[model samples]
Target: MAEEPAAPTGARSPSTRGTRRRGSARHRSYLRPEQPSGSPATSRAARRSARAGRRRRYAMEALAAFAGLLALVAFVGWWSEPARQEPPQPGGLPAVVGRPSLPGPVPTALAVPGLRPRERPPSPSPSAGPPSPAPVAVPTTLTVSQADIPDTVHLTETGRRDWMHWGLGGAGGTVRKRDGTGELRDLGGRGDRSGWDGNQELFRWRDGAPVKSVEATAEGVYVCGTGNGFQLAVAADGQPRTATVYLGVWMARGRLDLRSSDGGPSRTVRLEERHTSRSAQVTIRFQAPEGTRLLLSWTVEETFTPHCGNVGLQAVALR
Candidate 1:
């Protein structure tokens, strides 16, 4: 063909066509398989990895937006809420909700049963003088009667004879006597003396033993020995007169009688020996008119022996 395109310099000739074509065709096929496709031929594993990455990014962005919304809500609540206040303490002024305070002291009256409202007593007049003094009391005089004498008297016997001893032994025994001027003297062997000026005498029997007798002037008289008898006449003086007679006797066999000298009712007391050394006391009480006298008489009988018997008499007057 006009030298037909003069058969390009690098063109394959027909004679080597088979080998070159084969070689070149093999190379092109290998390179075509290695080149990227138009739409990528994704593998199953890579597609799954790409979808998971997109889901993770979306979750992160949504969480950040939720956190920002919570922060905004917290700020708005804090700015709108009211402030808090503390409660009042004890003994302090009470806090008022919406009111005023009460004033004044509390009243303390209580109702009582069966009691009327009390009225105050009237005050004394200003012109009234001081109250008069109360009157003093005077005690009245008291009079005693024979009934005041005690019904019982207690006494014990002293074995010694020094209290009063009568003259016995005929002439050598003790003699006790009171003269008209009230002077008493023991004139026998004993030589005793006293200044008692009253009429009294101690007598003795012919057998020399002292005999019992009434010594009218002595304050007290003692008698002893069995088969003895004596009488006493006592005078009373002063107005509203009363007298008490005391008789102390050995409780052997004896009888005692008391009667008014003017023949008033008589009272008698009797006793018999009991073989024991026991004593008795007798008290007599009676009213005696002024200038009157009382008669007391006693007798002792023979009973248990050593022939023991004893007695004493005393008279007292009250006005």
Candidate 2:
């Protein structure tokens, strides 16, 4: 080829020859790529796999975030609900009222659940009303005997303590049965300092453990109900044209007291054993103005033995 154009010196150099060969190989590799059969498909598949992997990762991250948010929302909702409360039961009764319904008959004690022992209510003032009729003279002076009257004694509001709801513990009692025997010995008050109570509305005594102490307070009367049968009788210095009455009947063991507005000695009401039975009856008699206000009470004393009693009012009628 015309002597190869005199074999250019620069091209004939070893380093230049090597460079040209390398360039040629590089050019051939770029142009034909040795006719690689599966290379393009493999590269395309790899790119697709990487893209799919990235998409899968994004989806998984999104799902994880969604699950976390859902759990957080559920927890928040559960924490925001209100708690439930229970209501009081039906048929429950209050602890205090004006007075019992009947006489001699054991009065009903106010019954309520969940009441605190120290929850004392203030006493109410006397009620204002018209003056009652005066006591009239009878044709003849008949000796009145202790008899079982079907009515119960009703205590006046003023008779109660300055802050006593029912006695001390929002309750009181009367003599159930007064057998001159030991049956009436156990005396206890549900309210009072003793704080003794029971399921029965009436105060009950264990066979040998009836209350042994009898005490009286401005709140009401407390008796052991078993001493030599209490002596319920008319006061010694009784006045004509006047009558006395007792209040409250249903209670544990205790006594009824007669207090004068003039601050005289109190006469203890007594229980009489009925001729028909061993049990006894409670009675109190005194002289008071037709509409005169009276104070009654049942207090717990600091004796070793316990005593219980009731508070109530008596009926006053002209002969």
Candidate 3:
């Protein structure tokens, strides 16, 4: 062979291979820990380091989760809050203000017809249930006697549906002057009744404070008191005339007596009771004096029950 191919340079003898392996092992030994299988202390230290690393990783993950939760909470809070409005002008207080606003344009003029004269409606027929009898305003005249005077009188200035008439006080009832000229003075100072003897209260009449011999005429009588009540006697000195009387009171259980005392024998012409809560009118035709003296006396002895002020006598007019 061409001088046997130069000895192969890459090939190693068995001895050389053994020596190189030994040197590699020696270098590895130098770099390794003192304990071939690792000392107990070193092994324990490595395990602790591994555990610390895992714990640190877990801690970082937890921190990240907490941060994420905080961010989510912040987002939800921001979304749930009401939308912010523009800041108010300085010194301007927030207040609720409402005003009427036209939906569109307003009209400048209105089309209305001029008012015309009106005509009255026709009256109902008689066959139609007594024809709602035309609202005939029949002015009434009332004649009052001394015996017909009420014991109490109360009135109101207001009106009510439950009452027949309302005027000034509680009942709003009043007694107008018969002559249409005169004022309501006192009860003439007629006090309470003295006793059960009716006559004792009959002739008893007082004015303001003194008992005068004169007699005053009134358009109506109003009363308020207790006991034997009050009395009045109006009789003419000569001719026979009809005495028309009207009595009204809020309370009930009152009595009235109209009698003739002149030209004719003294006789009971008309008698009535239950004059309260009603308006009473009586007409008695009898003989009377022309310039006769009429007596009106009142008294209060006891009360069955305390009562509020009420309408006594409303009015009295000579027919």
* Top-scoring candidate (lDDT): 1
What does candidate 3's lDDT look like per residue over 1-319, in tens digits?
3676665899988999999999999999998866656779889999999999999999999999999899778656644655335445568966323322233376433422352322234544447455465543322222443344443321111111011111222332233332221212223334331111111111111221121221322223344554344455543434434434444443434444433332333333222223234444444444444444333333333233356222233332332
Off by over 4 Å in 3: 1-189, 192-221, 228-237, 259-276, 294-304, 308-311
- lDDT against true structure, model 2: 0.36
Taking the tens digit of each residue's C-alpha lDDT, what string does model 1 give over 1-319?
3554577779888868988888999989888855344445556557889989989999999999999899768656654554343356578966544232232266233324444423334544567678888654322222222222233211111111112232233222333221111111221211121222121322121211133333222234445566565565545332232333333445456666667655555677765545643234344445544445556565565445564454433332221
Candidate 2 stretches with Cα past 4 Å from truth are 1-253, 263-266, 270-281, 285-287, 298-319
Taking all chains together, the TM-score of candidate 3 against the true structure is 0.27
TM-scores, one per candidate: 0.28, 0.20, 0.27
Candidate 1: lDDT over CA atoms? Answer: 0.43
TM-score of 2: 0.20
Each candidate's number of clashing pairs is 8, 54, 36
On a 0 to 1 TM-score scale, where does candidate 1 land against the true structure? 0.28
Q: Who wins the TM-score comparison?
A: 1
Candidate 1, pairs of clashing residues: 169-208, 170-208, 181-197, 182-196, 182-197, 182-198, 183-196, 183-197
Per-candidate Cα lDDT values, in order, are 0.43, 0.36, 0.39
lDDT of 2 by residue, 1-319 (tens): 3555566555577887899999999998899746375688888988999999999999999999999899778655655544333344467844333332223365333323443222234555689898999767322121222444332322222112110112333234332211222111123333432223321122212211123222322232323333311222222223432232322333333344545444544544443222211122333334543333233333222222233233232222221
